[model samples]
Target chain A: MLIDDNDIDLKINGKIVAFTKTFEDIVVCRSGEEALNYLKQHLTTPERLPEFILLDIQMPEMSGFEFLDHYKKLPVSFTEGCNIAMLSSTLDFSDIQRAEANPYVVKLLKKPLIPAVLQEVVKEHLQR
Target chain B: MDTPSVKVLYIDDEEHNLQAFKASFRRQYEIYTATSAAAGLLILQNIDINVIIADQKMPETTGVQFFKSIKDTYPDPVRILLTGYTDIEALADAINHGDVYRYITKPWSDLELHNSIKNAYDAYKAKIDLRNKVSELEKTNDELNRFIYSISHELRAPLVSVIGIVNLVKMEGLYNSSGEYWNLIEICSNKLDFYIQKTLQYYKNNKNVAEHSPVEFEILVSELISLYSYSDRDTQFNVKINQPVGFYNDAFRIEVILGNLINNAIKYQKSTEPNKFVNIDIDVDVQRAEITISDNGIGILNDHLEKIFNQFFKSKNHHGSGLGLFIVKEALTRINGKIEVTSDLAIGTTFKITIPNGKAT
Candidate 1:
């Protein structure tokens, strides 16, 4: 799943389309609130549940951090088969440390995410 | 913002003396005349006078006593005494106790009167100008504080978004078999990472003051070329550094300025063109060292060249926050260095920086 508050620019979306060619399914959400709503309704029925969510840090009403706060309260089943990765365009040390400290957060990815970074992520976590 | 002329208040008990004084200096100054000490004070309440010249003998009060009363209220104005021969002792007391500028005896010359007034006026003007400058600086300082606050808040918002995405990917093992899905996550992550690094560099550049040291020009240029050479391999861009013999300059500031220029040159270098390159030339003289960086890339337009050093000002085609040149300019200014730029669209851009060779005192 690809999630960001900004309507992803054409350059970024083009990159995303090329990336999703190998996946069986692709889902997108505009904000943290919409992503949470989608997950809550679909997780119980097994109709659609994303394996990983590419979450953006900034959003209206519910930010990425606020979404995580709410996500922590949901039943274990909601996240039983899911992983969360933060995707942002920021280099603030405090923000990186804060994300790393959260139990649910898996990794921090920089924007304009390219193929080399995907390979690194797979080598570190999925291959095992 | 034109300030009003300095006001002068002259007090004397004799009506003819008051009229004579006003008639003599009225055209040259903003003059207020009073016949008694009480009337002189009432005039002071209405006008912001710079000088107070009082006759030593008045009907109800001595000149020294009246000056002492108004000293706190008009501390900046130079006080002077107009005394007859009989009041010479009182003039001395006013000079010692009340801090009078000078005493004019009875039957004073017009030239002497004019000279004293001019001196007092010049001193008053200096005080006002200094006060104005200090207040203006305080206003600018307040504005800088506001800018820092907004910059911090804007930076924090994007950081939170990146963290949220990382958590979602970890639990599901979503891209286990999907190479394309993995690529999407990677691209997002890399862009975020680049932004974070650049932002941190910007913040650090603002806060960090580079320690001054003498730097060898040839060695520093070679090191900078090597640092950027690897990144330019795919584009196959050529970089050349030419340094004169025995050339040395302020090392820390030079490193920062060169780093930003080289980075910008590489960033704007067009991918389609082969044989793209950047060149650095260093010339040392007795007084100053001149370093120039020239690049054949997408050059800036005429309008943007003037404002390129302003904070957060970027070209429309560029992707970064537009802070690199601004930081470079600020760092150079701190070291008493100067920079000049020339560019032609589709041709190239060149930046020439001149730094003093000797150690700064």
Candidate 2:
């Protein structure tokens, strides 16, 4: 799943991941609110949840950090199976430090997503 | 032209002396006379006095003591001490610690008194002006720092996205078949990123204070060389260092100086030259490091060499934002370093830099 406000970023990152052939299907939400809603809808059915989610740091409403705050409240079954990583164009040190410190975030990757990095994250997740 | 009257305050214990003093300078200045230190405090609160003249032999407080007491509250007013006795110790103490502008003896000459008051007023105005200028500079620096932070983020976001899209296109093998537009996009994106990086370097050079750290030139030069190695240009880097002793200076500033000069060397390489190269030579001692970076590229003209260090001074056929060399010059100044450049058209350019050790002995 890709969560970002920029349409071009979502499309390109989605295409890049698709080319890697790692996931069967990709889900994209334009805002953190919409992404949270999707998670809530799929809370009962863990199988419907995405295996890996690439979240963008900057958004118009409810930024990526805020999304993580709301995400932690959901049942462990939903968050445990899914690996979340923050992808951002932000060059700020504080943003990088906070993302690294967040328990829910697996990695903080700079934009735009490279296919090899996405594959490696998935591989690392399966190994764990 | 008529000049505005300088507001003056004369404080004395005796009534006749205050009257005599005001009678002498009432036409030249707007004189406010107080017969006691307590009354003088009252007048200061009510009016904006430019100069204050106090009698040193008052009953409650000497002139130096009075000046010291009001130094904190009424610091802007220029203070002058008036005394009948020539007590050198008290006068020296007043001038050194009490912020006394000047001390005038009793039976004051009108001409001498007038000159002292005029000079005191001028000093007061200069102090205020200096403070205003300093505050204005701080405001500008703050605005510049904020502007750089926002502009770099705002401009680089979309620019990065475009590069990502380009990367995606290349991975799909679509760019190679229809490579013209893709190559153009790639070139334009790289150029934009380059300029943004240069601007950030300029800001960092101005904002950060130089730090003294032990620098290994071999590692520093190798890292910089690897950075430029990613470029498709065929220019080679030849480095030779003779640093037997420890060298300490601001490593970040040294990087700026070396990075800009090397970047310029690679950037201005003659496209047709098959064997182009940049030579970096460093001779280091405990006191200083002398470095020379030379390149066999499309060399700068004599006329352009002098103006190249000026901010935003772009020569003909210049590919950069013209900030590279200017940042190098500024970084040198901060580190107490010096640079000398010599270039010939179609021959080559060399920059010689001498950076002193910043570590305190």
Best by DockQ: 2
Q: Interface root mean square deviation of every model, in Å? A: 9.3, 1.2
Q: RMSDs, each prediction?
A: 12.1, 5.0
* Maximum-TM-score candidate: 2
Worst 10 residues of 2 chain B by lDDT: B227-236
lDDT of 2 by residue, B186-210 (tens): 9999899888878778777888888
**TM-scores of chain A, one for each prediction:** 0.83, 0.94
Error of 2 at A101 (Å): 6.0
Candidate 2 residue-wise lDDT at B258: 92
TM-score of each: 0.44, 0.76
Per residue, candidate 1 scores C-alpha lDDT tens digits across B50-158 of 8888988887897898988877877777777888776757866887778788788877788898898888777777888888999999788666655664575465444
